[model samples]
Target: MMAAFKVINQYWLISITLICSKILPISSETFHTRLSPSYFSQKLGKIGTKLIINGIDSHYRSFFARVQHLTTPGFCGAAILDSRFLITSANCVHSVKPQDIHIEIGDFSLQDVQMTIYDVQDIFIAPGFNLNNTPINDLAMIKTEEPIPDAHQISIGICDEEDYDMINYQKSVFGCCGMGSTNKDPFIKLIPQVLKEMHFRGTPMDESNPERFLPCREDNICTRPMIDGGSICNLDHGGPLYKFRCGSFEPECLYGVASYSKRKADRHFQTCNTGSFFTNLMYFHEWIALTFLQNSF
Candidate 1:
């Protein structure tokens, strides 16, 4: 029965993969018109200032062959330790060379002047990561050659283990950030947008994949938006879902990269829905310490 189930799942995945290959066109004007001003207002409410990475244009040009460029591509990532390191989803680094990935900071318009481009020297993928499950180990670390200056904008937060444990499955909120999409249309030029918060139910993992380092409970929350390859800002898998410390929204670290949804259709159907999974970073804290921070102290 297990074998049969595996075969059925593979068949379904293949069918979906084939359908996602086709490109659908959308006009820019129509795309922008579809988005309500309220949506932008809502997004801005969560994150006041936008962060842009500089040197992305030249990097994109140099490494376009690699890296999966999403239709509406810019994704949000937090600066780790004063811009020397960045914590983001593994999907962001998947299949791309170190030279290709560029870090952008500040607003979009002045990206060229404000952003800092760093060449990735090493990429560390969490162990036991499965492409199918995309479980917790869906995290990666990008090591830059040189340290970035004026990295005051880059900050890391402490993980709230207490909040994560007390989280109510039904009422919990999952916040995510990225370049917001204009519309569900597939052909629109991808614009760089900022973060947005959405409410979701917590769905934990049934069984832990310790080897791959994934831990999720049925009650863990996930975003149901159409975008894929984005990170859960304050959660595990590098970006931790954070709640504002002073208010009800203090950023707290929760789940990590585990799994994501693939495009199964086009603009007309469920094609807009792209789900990404992350691993719980807390589970692999030891690993990160041994690997990245071992020699720091």
Candidate 2:
């Protein structure tokens, strides 16, 4: 009797696993690749100079100063609006103390640029952000002690009303930029690895309410490509998401800071693919204008 019971249990477990795999389908293989630490280090070395923040140093770009915490160490972020400010998800730094946050800029290989440490005077977390839901207001801003001159001149993308119409059901391509995780868990290995491909087509918008959920507009589509917590950015968080405009692709607007993923419903024990989300910056346009632009530094 005991032997028969064990066999039945094993059969059921395998059956369920197989069924779930089919429903999600593990995304497309054209999407996944495993990246080693050495490869990531090399990639960072190549792109590090372009990721300047506050004109202080090149090393500062390695990690977003505000988001790193004691528990999950060495997380990455991007500079959104030049060197002075960085836009990252609020969840990244949810546990970090304000005083502990530090920004590393300058040289990629550790010796070229001087590192500048800035005190975070204030942090603006978006309203109505739910840890469980991962709502639209997942955005946050980190204000540094001093402004880095020439940081504003760096090109950043802006959201336009036209994007809402163009993005719907169109073959839109988004580049997923960020550092890969060093954590190794058996379950995490199953999904299509995130680092191999930099960009992919946006998934079609499901028939869902736009007012409550994100990617609220037609042009404002969202992606679950890969690389969570890392901003979907070029060198910095405030980096632009370029759309093919006019005769050529231009960096017209900046979108949201990349945030956490929604878990798969069926897999109670395992995390689904790295379903990345970004905090929509459009919601806080007035606030940004008031605080960063109009207010005296």
Candidate 3:
């Protein structure tokens, strides 16, 4: 009974995933969109699928941390930045106290990996972050009680403008990876925390759409699912919008943070592939470096 109270309010700390649907698309009409993935074959790209980039566990290595809200049992996406720091969206930890939240790692498939939970020693949100605004310096870092073992420090990446732009125009498809919300429902034992992945294409900035209000300027990058029926729905916030480098097989850079997505209909309670927005990581590279230095000692 106590376990039931834990997951009642969990949400995806990553995206509300912008890409269109996946795995056979919902229908003939749902399978075709301007930015949808080119092929409709049985290739894998779904929210619950195990991450298999180049057949390695690289995805699990990096974004293995979950910033769990102790009381609400809510969660947000986070990743290992260094031995002592885990990074996530500033809004994810903005209002909560450091002691109230915990970081859980070392688990991929909820059933397989032995989970290690750590208390947050400190919380550091980016400078000038505003929750009212969709995406602007939407970043944060948390210090653990002690350094996470180096063996668990597998996923590492950089945020440089050069690499960010290269993937922006050059890459044909980008992958949004996350282990989003696992509803804390009673009938179910809690969903799988396995890393899931989806594909989407960069879309032109749309500032005047009424159904959505995300402004994809220098700080935010908008996306349309590369395939129809794909989306990073609710409970998947603070997720990563990443892709492999040119001629490289591994995803070494995380370019953006999944912020939010528009609803399917004005009053409906579903996510739409209509559009999605993410916080650009390159924009805050200097600030992040500075923030890390200030907290290093």
Best by lDDT: 3
Per-residue CA lDDT of model 2 for 102-193, tens digit only, reads: 55443233433354555565565655555554444555666666765556555254565545343431443343333333222223322112
Model 1 TM-score is 0.54
Name the regions of candidate 2 deviating beyond 4 angstroms: 1-67, 70-76, 94-97, 106-117, 153-155, 166-169, 180-197, 203-221, 224-252, 263-274, 293-296
Runs of candidate 3 exceeding 4 Å displacement: 1-61, 107-110, 133-135, 151-153, 170-172, 182-193, 207-215, 247-249, 264-267
- Which digits, one per residue and each the tens of the lDDT, describe model 3 over residues 6-53? 432221101112221222223435324211333212233233333321
Query: For candidate 2, what is the TM-score?
Result: 0.54
Q: Whose TM-score is higher: candidate 1's or candidate 3's? A: 3
Ranking by TM-score: 3, 2, 1
Could you tell which candidate, 2 or 3, scores higher by lDDT? 3
TM-score of each predicted structure versus truth:
0.54, 0.54, 0.71
> Model 1's lDDT to the true fold?
0.39
Q: Pick the candidate with the highest TM-score.
A: 3
lDDT of 1 at 95: 60
